[model samples]
Target: MGKSQKKRSMRRHNPMRVPDSHLPKGLAAASESSSKTEAILPIIQKMQGADAAERKWACVAVSNLIQNDPSTRRLLQGKNIVGTLITRLTDSEEEVVVEAAGALRNLCIDGGYDICAEMYNKSILVPLQTFVPKLSTTLSQYLDDQKTAPENAQKLVYEFANNVITLLWCLSETSNKALNAINQLQLVPFLISFLGARQKIPLATVTAAAQCLYVLSDDNPPAIADLRADGGYIACLLSILQEPPQDEADPRTGTLRVLAAGILRNVAPLPPPSVASALDLDAEIVLPQLTPLLSISLTEVSETALQLLGSAPETEKPKDSGLKNTPKSDHKSPAEVGLERLENRLRTVQLALEILTGACATLPDPQPDVLIDDEDDDEEGDENSDDNPDADMATPEEAVPDSREQTQSLPSLVTPLLQLIQPTTLSFPPLAAPSPHPPTTSALSAIHLAAFECLNNIFLTLARDRHANAADVGAVWDAIWTALGLVGTQTGLGQEQRRAVWEAATGVLWGVATVSRGIVEPKPEQVQALMALCDGATADAQLRVKCIGTLEALAQNPAFVDANATIAVYLLSMLPSANGPSPAGTEPMLQAASSLIDIYSDEDAPWDINFRSGGYLARLQGSVDGIKTAVRAIDRRKEGGKELRRRGEEVRDNLVAFIKYRKDLGL
Candidate 1:
């Protein structure tokens, strides 16, 4: 060979080669790509082989390759290895089936929607459904013949069952198509049966089965129905939860508890029958067990506790004595770790608030007017029979029964919720020293919003039940005001976060105002805070509308009519003009305007001086003109535009009526 050719050959066959990282970016990428490609073809060929052992080894090799490497996963997906695996799921050899199942489950680790869709299209669920029941039956038989069964026979059964169920859980999360397909196969009932037969089944198998049920029935009504039909499923889950973990190192305990709690969260929000069934279960015992889990440092445990409690819990934090004085290593600082823990805790609290909202679904409908039929002759006759005109407008206290005295006393969830909103003294150094970041502030805001939501639910429930005493109502009101002030001071937060805080603050304010209508008097600071929220230019329009609505609710109390007169003028100024943005804003604007008119027309309203000085009448005239102009500006041809015009016209007519009523009263 020539000298130049010999040099090139020597470079290609060098004993020591340059690492990819040391090479140019493009060269490194190309070399890594070439390596993955080189590995894919051999694995694919081996997986397609007729020999069970070769195919099984190929499955294991592919599984290891794609375990954590996204690039390898995509490469394998392109090579149709999943198709090979799915075919192997039905292999005659049990070892090959187990290996293929494990491989597919690994592929789905973080596969997300695309991988799940591909699996569904490849008819993966068919073999999974067929194999699951057969495997389950075989496992049961093995359990029955425990004395004569092979040593590893039970372990093998558990491995196969867990792999299939875990894969199903992944697929179900990808899309409704996979969920619906699985539901159609009627595996949910079978899965619940497995859970119910807890002592007979392996713990790992039971945990997998519970997780599968959680995924399948999450928001799907049909799956929920199948579980609810047995009625004993809830009891079975509770029993599993009540059993203490075998030891501290038992990993399966946490998984089983979380899954069981998740299933309850899903089932608790179903129709009345399902909710009633759940409510009848032993919450007294279940809640105490769940409350302690909230303070467990693990995010999964706390999150599940929040889910199960559904706006409920309390217990001391668990001590991790082993790690307390451990030597430091190359890892995140204490501040960073604390921030993560705080974020997770805030998320858990947020989930609890969500559950609280769901719990309200079972309460009696608070709005009695909706149920009253105006067309019924008897109802109309009864209304006419009342000689006192004011009798028809009786307060909620007089109209509704005091059911709180007779109903069961609910757990006190407010104490812990209030504690969460209270600012904590961070033991670690502040995160803002070196550079400012939002993780801490954002987490605080989330906690605040969650606390506000829980407070709102609590007050609403109290109002509906008519059980709230003066002290309880006062405590809730004070907490809401404090939360509002905190949100107001947080100018550094993002607009979206601030907007959420404002929305939640207004909701809590509205709920308190609603529940305390007749019992508690409005404070000036409370009125001023609400006014500031409505008048703030940067405030979200929805929040502004809600604040105005709350003010209107408070105006119903005679003691606050004079204070609300200025609020009425502000409401009039906020009326939508012809050139205003967002047509959707019209509805709430109209509602506010109507509420203002209601306030001003009240008998005790100090309308004489306030109306003259505030230009209230002229503002109403302007509002009517502006709305009419907006109506005319809308295109009459399109359905949406026509509807907008109709609403605008209705608002204008209402404004005109208010003006005429005041004029007739000689105000």
Candidate 2:
């Protein structure tokens, strides 16, 4: 081995141990503490203080404290802690309430409504929902005074709503409590009210409301009906469409957009077509608004518009001029305005269609063509050129050009969105530019979020429909992966946003693995491309976490296991030690070693040829070489193979037993 290789090889095998300073204090303490509840409640109480920022810190502390402590089960048994925390919902400081709300959310993350009810008993749920009206009133008055509120009242309300939504999601399985909470808040209306505000509300408010509706619709149809009964279903969704995103497009908007799409999709197929729709939702009203939205030049809005259109039924035929005819507008076309370039105009039309059609994977039937005989075309063209040529226009069949087949690999829908989101500067640069207007970081963020939302919808459609076009899938993936590369850029994104981006990208990556089965070879090149972007040299913590997550997912897939195994091994080997016994040379290794090992082990492992047979096993065995190398390294010095193996075997046995138990129970 060379010096670098030899050094790496010779390094002590350390199990992954993240640094204490790196970890949230509450989480670290909770992990190390002998008594789980004993270590956590005080931190949880601290979050109930009056100082919003202080409480925010306390919330973080509480979230961390619960990080690895499933043993706190008994402490949570009676909901005493939940009840205590909920009382802080009415704290004077919004941040304090936000933190307390967040803490309550964490408690119910796994325990569900049992925990939520305990919180509700403290009257937290009522305040949590009621706070929105108060904030709305406060915000309206403040806007009238033209004074920006010192506290982020909008953000506070959103956080409160988020906590409630999360809690309801957990409790949704119990007592129709989730449904009750949504109805009580009439959250859809509260969220829609913010759509017209001049002051920017955090994107979280809209997203939370949307997600709650989504869960409710999925869990209970009656809940969706009730939401509709409140007289704001379409209005709420449309209001979100109307709102201008912050400079950095918030992921919350993207989330809300997705939820809205899901809502439309869920409601679209089953609702009876009516002469007058239940909500007076004429395509006339929606379509005109959509036309302007399509031209706003933001990818997220475009994507969202496409999703809405996709969900909307095609109710009436066009009023002549076909799809290409531009609506009457002040800005004349290139020809009318004396600036028309045929190719450029075509591109604009394509983009407009892309936005309006909801990123349609399948093209409509080709338009009628006016056949032209080239040999005799000069005489006919000369005659036609004298007439109103633009009126008689060449159809897409004639105008798209011979190069379209070659250039159209990327869907027309996603390619433009990707272009908009692509960062001009790869690394941070000196503030040298003196342009009249500079792009704000918020705008850039908004673009990224918009791109992600579009891609998510496209992927979901592909998964659900199965008949979704492959070229469309490929094009969408190409654009999504390109944007995904920017997730770790030093200056472009915040830590929280970056994490969200990574998580969103993970969903796409996971979909690629899951959806591509039997159709294509798990393209190793694609995985490698993602791996490279995700594994930056500076090693941003969020990037590494997301990278590890994506890598773990890739390694689990049988088809990709062999192709991606080496990269997986490389990533796993970099797992930081969990203990602070640092002999670390480079940045202290993150404490992800155990997670890596656990990922590779298991009786259901892709390489477990005992159950799998034929060429599949052979392919899996090829991938086994890399996993085995890492296993050996763990065995040699880390002493972690035993724990991993034990955990893996335990999981495998449980799965098998569960299968047997399910069979017996006929469940």
Candidate 3:
């Protein structure tokens, strides 16, 4: 019977079942969520009961039950618990309401996008509208009376407000209706009130406020307008940026500042001087205020800041070094302490990377343009600025946002980014037996993705601008090559993250290779690895093109001529025969044309180059009829790209040059 059935999803996360002293022992040990009805059913009954205390207990129980356990989420959700929880939002018991909100929020986390969508469809925003605002009044009372307020009362208000704000963020993230409700209900100003309080409000509540604003304001016009119209909201976010990223354990870690920057970043093309000064924001002052955050975020992590991730955690010792070693905090075990340190480091670094990325608006473009304005027009060493589109590194067209130059330490960031994205062997570095918990594969991949994106912008910029100092170009390219070839080795890596890495890595190698041929010495294995990708028909189209582009980029340097020539012959085989119909997609055809042109098109290239001089160019000449047939076929297709057509013409012209050069040599 379906009643006796258990969900596969729940079974997987049964290992994360919440520990509760009051739970039935049999239910706690039950292997399946369905079999644990003895435990879960009572909580549902209690939540639907008259006693407020039991209902509160049940609300917290559901929250604890589903922390990371999705099976239980599906089971409870199937039981219609969300609707029951919704009713509690209007329950007379404030404690029940708070716990209920906490439960709904947990469901949002455990159930992911689907559950959040479910909650929204159930009309959660209706009760939440009237219920959520009351939390602010309680918080306001606590804010006014410091000594007179009971400590428990203050904690309750903080918990209630924090949970509700977080719940709203989860809700708004799910659907357009909820997002519209957010602006209509004027939640931005309410959240701004807490964030602006700064030191006065609990950091958790402030973080909740910051997080909600960060989510709602991103790419949402109404929310962005709400944030923009409220100058105090902007100030609240800015004030956080003004402070240094604080000690992790110390409540003031600059997470708020990071979120603040994100919110401001969304409000881009930031109003003109009037927006900055006279019209909108005091941007003249806002501009300098932004520098401190960037300066702090961009600086390489200090030895002390990153030491925990390197070495195992040890307890604090007394000055005399005679007393038994005291535990660092609350007698925590080395493993526990090590895990904490690792988590803190990952959290800090990822947040910093986000800020650095945001400062440049690094998304969607290979060459990131700064969205926020910089006071000075200091181009530094960027010889190929916006003026010369044909310059090795031409300026990106102005984005919708106000454009500025790269950050001061942007180029120098290569070393730090390189350190974050190492080969698999170095991923878990040796650190005694109990290693200071190495980064999880997912975390490492995420860091690699962000780091590579940063590198891509840098390399592409440097390549285009003809800036020679591509800090550690060899190491950067190696990391990128490793990512490109990671599918077989690291199965845990996400495709999207891997694709991002490839995009960044290719952009990086393309730029570095463009600036100078030999900066990244070409290895035979690297060439073979790239060729291997092009060999398989089942390989990704983008991967194939990127692989071909990488070979072409490296071919510019003489050190890679032999390797490039080998791939050139391989690509020549794929060209359509003069008698055959051309392939529908021009990518492979265009890629072949582009690579052939880069090689044979340079007539003056030295004899050491294997193109015509080494029989490879003769091979191209033999296949010229077939290649032209393909180009003609491309021209015949309605959807054939202009660039593809142009590349075909160039290939045809280059082949003509090859024939003349051959005739002149009397070969």
Candidate 4:
């Protein structure tokens, strides 16, 4: 055969080569010519197509495209595709609605805060709200027919509800405006109702609803009030925590518990009325449930478990069965798996601790009885008196106890919190080289800060309780001290973490000083540590204030006063304009000054004379001048500054009185 004919034969016989006639006409040419805009335009058009199947396919395509490509998401956003998707949310075709909801959910998940805000601006909530009841009805029907319904159909219903709830959850995290939009839709009650114990909802839907509430109510009072009004919501959440899904190893159950605990934390600090209601619900029943969660580490598996299930094919058998005939696989034991799951949920532990803190703060104080005059009067005179004579008498204002002072004991919280605060070396990735100062690994640092805050709150509660024993007080103090020491030794924590440690430490110390009432002595090391913190140039302003305040509390003890006389001197120096102290610093600075004056000044003439004789008068005079200067510089027109100026004036007056009385004694 000729060479050219041989080559032609080889091409025709080769299995890998395709004839031009076998290929779609001009496909390569179309691909080379099409721009991204042209490519997506067809999908966008299909999304708005009249046919339900076309719209569903388009929505799924859009969801898949946006999930894998950021530019595709921005393209869709720029094209105003969300508006069409939102409209499809209420389509008569359930498949179309599911695909549209799924598409929007993907947009929210990938688009971040800006996309959420855009969705809010587009008024997505109106359509979302309209669809919720319909979705719920459909979900109920599918669940009711679970045995007979196609498994895929039931799964689609679950995804539809889950997607809507997840979208709302995303919106809730956007900003206050978005959160308010959700609340304004009056969706809080609906979401809470989904959590009803009798409601037979998918676990994913319930978990999503709980998380939505948690995010919505974070620092949001009105939403919290709405949740509080839901008759069984708190009970429902508490019940979930109390009787978690029987499968401890199920990631969904762990997630459900974590979400429930977080919701409780959000509800714990509601306004006094709502808080009263929360307390009345006996939500503390979950404390024991939460205690065990403290040791569990939160893992991403819990977060993505639903997605994993959704992605798996229904016909696929359990992977475990594949290994059944072979030697047993080294699968993690249930206990080990439980520990890992707990460790994954460290944030849940933090939330539980915070809830305990708020719960302790809400314990009601005893009401005082009104004093009535017992003077006897003639019957005729009593009858002649005004019928409501007490009305004209101005009532004496009752002294309100500090919120912290109204604490109740939660002995159950102590052990779990101590366990969390106890230091353990955590594994970290190997560093490039050993250095003099290594920062704390992020995971352990977060755990430490959370545990320390819990410890501080517990100590504050203990300090205020008149019945707290010396042993309990000492134990808390020791925990605080140990945690503080550990924090101090950690070389590489971020500024925020360090600030947290300092604040927590100082807070506990201050609580001890206030609650001890001279019963518990301040440790010398703690005193010195606080003094050093005050002197540190890198210390945060709030931390400095807390340190100074703690020192003031410590100075109340005569033993502390003699040992840390320099703290008084340093504090007094801050009172002057030269130190450039912030207005927030004024109160603590003045308290420290007053405390020192009380320590040094005397009722008898002897100490006063000796104070003046020792050249301390000049130092006191400098402080007095400094306070006066600060008072003049303050903007008294502002309410906060007015109080600070008033405090400065009071300090100056006290110093003037002490100086004048000493001068009058003929010093």
Instruction: Write the residue-wise lDDT of candidate 2 on 306-403 in tens digits.
Output: 34334423333324322121221222332322111221222222223323333322222223343334443333223213443244334334433342
Error of 2 at 385 (Å): 74
Clash tally, candidates in order = 0, 22, 12, 11
lDDT of each: 0.58, 0.43, 0.57, 0.57
| Model 4, span 121-223: residue lDDT tens | 8888888887678766765565566576777876786777788888888887776667667777666766766676224656667767776777666656787
RMSD of every prediction: 15.3, 24.4, 12.1, 17.8
Which is the better candidate, 1 or 4, if ranked by lDDT? 1
TM-score of each: 0.58, 0.35, 0.69, 0.62
User: Arrange candidates by TM-score, highest first: which order?
Assistant: 3, 4, 1, 2
Model 3: which ten-residue window has the lowest total lDDT? 1-10
Model 1 error, position 230 (Å): 3.7
Give the top-scoring candidate (lDDT).
1
Candidate 1 TM-score, true structure as reference: 0.58
**Tens digits of per-residue lDDT for model 1, 84-200:** 899999888898899899888877753445676788899999899887678767766766776656758767777888888878877777666677788787777667766776676
**Candidate 4 ranges beyond 4 A from true positions:** 1-134, 147-149, 197-200, 215-244, 251-344, 362-412, 423-447, 465-467, 470-475, 488-495, 516-529, 535-541, 556-562, 577-588, 594-614, 632-667
Candidates 1 and 4: which is better by TM-score?
Answer: 4
Error of 1 at 588 (Å): 3.2
Q: Per-residue lDDT for 437 in model 3?
A: 26
